[model samples]
Target: MANQTEVLRLLMANAPEYCSGDRLADELNISRTAIWKMVQGLQTAGYSIESRHGRGYRYVENNQLSVAGIQNGLDITPAVQLIVLPSVDSTNAYLKRMATRTPLTEPVVVVADSQTAGYGRSGRTFYSPGETGIYLSIGLPVTTDQPLDAGLLTTSTAVVVAQTLRQLFDVPVELKWVNDVLVNHHKVVGIMSEGITNLETGQISTVVVGIGINLTTAAFPSPLQSKAGAVLAHPTKVTRNQVIRQLLRTFFERYPSYRSGDFMPLYRQLSMVINQRVSLKSGARTYDGVVLDIAQTGALVVQLTDGRVQEFSSGEITKVNLLTGQYHG
Candidate 1:
């Protein structure tokens, strides 16, 4: 019997035209019942599937999360293995377990339609609700020729996401210190990167970048109602699959430019922190500073209030009101 991926490929490949059950079953060597089940599963995942009594099933359209839809016209192939799930606790957590179980030979991208335990920097829960947000993690193993710049992948990814949103929606997107994407003073996306290192060789064994994006406008919990923003404030035909394709396409195709810091100029252009007075935190200590510049190595260079200069690579920029440019909750 064929899997859901194959079934979806067939349906999406022949959109607006129904594929007979018998023919689909014969092609996949699965029973008609199995085909019916697969179609039900796809429908449950937010795909728009139309059915008729004897016409079998036809794909009406997909403005939702569809792996087959994502793979259909995405030209950047051979770089990452894409895995889509209807739901997962967290794509980052899933990838960590996967890398731990079997050493990956190539890069792997895992995307979830929704995340249950989605989290961000500082172990805070990332507000991820169903059918409207994107939670993805790209696992990069040391096996690929792409040299791992442990310091900048998160920063580079921020650039890619910010650019993707701006290119698709023509909205002004801004980047907070490390990995937050903002618009209209609300955070629409959060990025977190985790990695394991080979202690003996002092090399990275695996690294995963988790990106959680509020794709469409949806109600949020009372706590996050003020800060979490959606990429599309209103409705549109833009789907999660389309956004994923554009992001992955640019991320891999321009791997060198981003990974090597050549994309810093654009990163700077979208930065919301430059020249802003900010609060910083490093381990048990905290300080206040005025942003100076983003170093070539993707560090935040700051001129401390105490007449000292400091650079932060992995430290947190203490929560400042993104809207008012003041240090607050």
Candidate 2:
């Protein structure tokens, strides 16, 4: 399969003005019929190709994103390892199983080409199309001596993802508070963190940060199509592999700050909720308030209408009824 992909890649790299069938066959040492079949296979693999009757084949000029390139581009420490799988139910679930067996010093990454049962918060179905996006999970072991605040971890991870995107692509990236990345007010990336802490020792044993991103999107379900977008949907062109490598590198660089308890200052630099109006909801309770600041512990400080301030932890957030600005009561 690798050899076949190499041949296809070579053909694509030399295409766009048409690589004659005879020339492609000679170059790949395969027959013209075999070359034809390979072209059809590439098309079926979500690659766009243009064929002309007498002119042979031409590639539509895509970024040719793949797992191999992503692995090569990642700049993680020796403790981190990359695992690429052909298919899986979910990257997060796979990492959870491996974390139990792998040593704390060794961090493992699980990446899937396709997902069978992708999910989100509250059991929401996450649409994970094969070979068209990025799905990955990272395994990290927090020290037994220092247990991180849950809210701080979430906000720090969010900042890491946003900064990575800024480094990799020329697109605008925004933080959706807790852990989501948006481009032009449309969600392009979702971050979910799961960890197991030893209550007796006050330490986090294992932490898994799962990331999902849309790289090249043609369409999505109508329900969320308008509210979500792909990185490529912006004016700039971005490949999945490029984004993945940058994300891993940025996370490692920021992990030290988080571990040293110096993340509060850095978190404030990237936070988006300071002095903004936001709607907060927890279970059956909901209220509107002006976002004053995000505390070092990761709670959002909001001043209510009655001149009182309230702090909220993890919850559903919105911008209130008005589409233009803040949701202050």
Compared with the true structure, what per-residue lDDT tens digits does model 2 show for residues 1-329? 23456555665566557778888887778788888888888878666677888988876644444454565446566557777777899998888877666635667788887788777777877778876778888887776465655667667887787787777777777665677677656777777888865556755788888888876665888887767788766434555656777888887877766744466665566555667667778778887888788766677788987889988778867663433543222
User: Which pairs in model 2 have colliding backbones?
Assistant: none
- The lDDT for every candidate, in the order shown, is 0.83, 0.72
Model 1 lDDT tens row, 1-329: 48887988898788779999998899999899999999899888677888898888998665677667777778874567889887899999999999878767788999997888998887999988877888899987864466677668888899999989998896768888787898777789999888866666776788898999898858988898877788877876777788899999988876655667888898899888888887888788887888889998999998988889888887887666444553233
The candidate maximizing TM-score is 1
Whole-structure CA lDDT of model 1: 0.83
- In candidate 1, stretches whose alpha carbon ends up further than 4 angstroms from where it belongs are 1-4, 14-46, 51-58, 143-146, 198-202, 319-329
Off by over 4 Å in 2: 1-68, 101-104, 197-204, 234-238, 260-272, 320-329
Angstrom error of the Cα, residue 280, model 2: value is 0.8
The stretch of ten residues in a row with the least summed lDDT in candidate 2 is 320-329
